[model samples]
Target: MEFRRLIRGRVDEPQLERIGREIAKRYDRESVRISVLEADNWLSTPCVVDEEWFVKVISPQNALVQALFTGARNLGVFSRGEEGFFERFEDPLAMSQHELEATRRVREIGLNAPEPIEAFGVDEFGVLVLEYLPEFRTLDELPSTEVEALASELFSALTLMHANNLAHGDLRGENVLVHGGELYFIDATNVRKDGLSTARAYDIACAIATLEPALGANCTVDLAAEHYDAATLLAARDFLDLVRLRPDHEFEATRLKGEIERRAD
Candidate 1:
């Protein structure tokens, strides 16, 4: 946790105040209330603005960390003899803009995504604003039974994403938020436009790893198969071991592999 904090860096109080002032200016408010969110975000400082806007204050360091992560993920894909798929931004503002566009695209495809507001640079930090969902629980915070009930919709949403030439790239518990009893995706990592197929499969693998702990291997595979065929699911097999290596994902890779094969047969 401490290491993560160091890598995420910090937005000092003065910078926070400046960002708040910018929000106030944008909304034509005399002042806006700002409160930092407790998140294990690797790329940006997330906060709520005036209780109405969800904001991310991204710094140069955050952009560097994002690039580093992208490089590492690409290397993982390369290890499996496939070209890397993840994309990286040049700087903080670009990172903010990319997320803004990605979130908007997700919403366009009939999925629940926060309404993207805008992206602007304040000093060296890039600020991203979006509509805030007042009450929400991350997928990880939900119980196993609740996760099971939501499994179909979750995979359904993922299918919608891939069918439309979109891929979440990063789909873990924290990125999947439950609000108003529906699944909303956030913090999508950028992937190569030409690599959507690989990205789609990788996303499926990540999704499987994410739900396996809660729904168990068989139930998770069954739910996934509702939208993906045996071949499509099999495409994700190469990324399973890679996804499992992520600390956020800890599932039975061997068990999932067996279930996926059984479904194929």
Candidate 2:
């Protein structure tokens, strides 16, 4: 779709009050308060629910939401019969449920993800409630050392996810939030628990591409080369090849394959 961020800003008090009321009524919960979380989210505005959970709000009638859903369908990410598929804008509950399940599965694999609570409704809008991360920072604001440390941790996390046959299809920097030394991955809607091997490679590539702008490409590449094995590195290189063809082409993959085989030897 468009390589652009969705609009994000303040949600007025009346609307926030309405959202809180909706959550309480839909989920049969009480004393739920809503406040905007850290800014700059693409599709939805995540708000804190009480002090224990977060809720991502998406209005069904919003043009941006429609455009995003349309883009998702166009990308074949939301097929008709899929587990998370929704045919109408008024049906984000399914998509929100899928996102919850994706995070739950990733956590089951021993990765970091907030515990998913429930998806609730407020009029024509949907809200995904999740466990709170009391102290978390986005990837964009980290220092060099933190970036390198995160780079290595990200590789480890990605390797573990791939080994478990899962791929975070949208592995961008913004999707990763850090607290202390722990990395909590948000926006799990696109995570593929039964993804193809190529999809896994793309996951790696997306991580690399997202990190390159913050940390230099060469530095990120070197860290990746050091963090992962030859096979994974070769796969990453294959992804780079897709983005921009190298003159070495066949030789690059072949050479990396040879190295892997030599290690076996």
Candidate 3:
């Protein structure tokens, strides 16, 4: 296994080697493909080692990964480790086990989701092997009309997840993929198996909020109204407005709040 070593901390070379070996061994492939993906704000840039299955593996940035996933930040000095910066180092395998299970569950339920080929117990690799759909495009790349259509398609996936008592804690455009006129949901890191949880509302709100860039903030409200009842729409609007008010990005919150209030009237 060859490690590109584009960024030192990004890919765990040893783990990558092990993963590659395991993949080759399991599949009886003689040669393995390896490539590096640059890091981005949304996800830890993972290396694509197996082109055949599109294997994306993240080294255990453990607590840091968890914090980023949950949008939680703390002031602390950075300490280097295999997983990444961590206040207290956590085992990568232990941390990623739940996520792997959640992702597999999404597939088991027949949602248009990634097939979790290999998940937990991959030797501290924290690897999430997913079926690669190269044709899928993010919501940002789609036009307004397609964005609205994708929004409706997303609602169907959301319904399946919620009906099974699963809430994709992170509901953003980047997490939704569209291919061959079908919508597929990915990134199960934040899934919670509780339909009744407030997180479900958050998912709906986040979905609508994420579509605002392409669909327009006001337009998304109407789009969501097509599928959701009055109460749910109201709840989604409230949540979307609240997210806009976070300290760093509160400029739009007041306007959104006023809009929601006026709509209620």
Top model number, lDDT: 1
TM-score per candidate: 0.95, 0.71, 0.75
Model 3 gets an lDDT of 0.58
Give a tens-digit lDDT track for model 1, residues 187-232: 8654666788889889999999999988899999998988889999
lDDT of 1 at 259: 96
- Model 2, 68-158: lDDT tens per residue? 6446533443232223322233364555666777788789999999888877666655678888888788776688678777788888888
Question: Which portions of model 1 show Cα errors greater than 4 Å?
Answer: 189-193
Q: Which wins on TM-score, candidate 1 or candidate 3?
A: 1
Over 4 Å off in model 3, which ranges? 1-9, 12-15, 38-43, 68-90, 120-123, 189-195, 241-255
Summed over model 3, clashes come to: 2
Q: After superposition, how far is residue 155 of candidate 2 from its true place, in Å?
A: 0.9
Superposed Cα deviation of residue 15, candidate 3 (Å): 5.0
Residue-by-residue lDDT tens digits, candidate 3, 1-265:
0222322246556666777787777779885776765433233445565655656565555435555534332121111111111122255554445555777778777877766666544665555666777666766568888887667777777777877767676566666778888877765543334324455566677776677667665766666667776676666555554455322122344444455556666
State each model's C-alpha RMSD to the native. Answer: 1.5, 7.3, 7.4
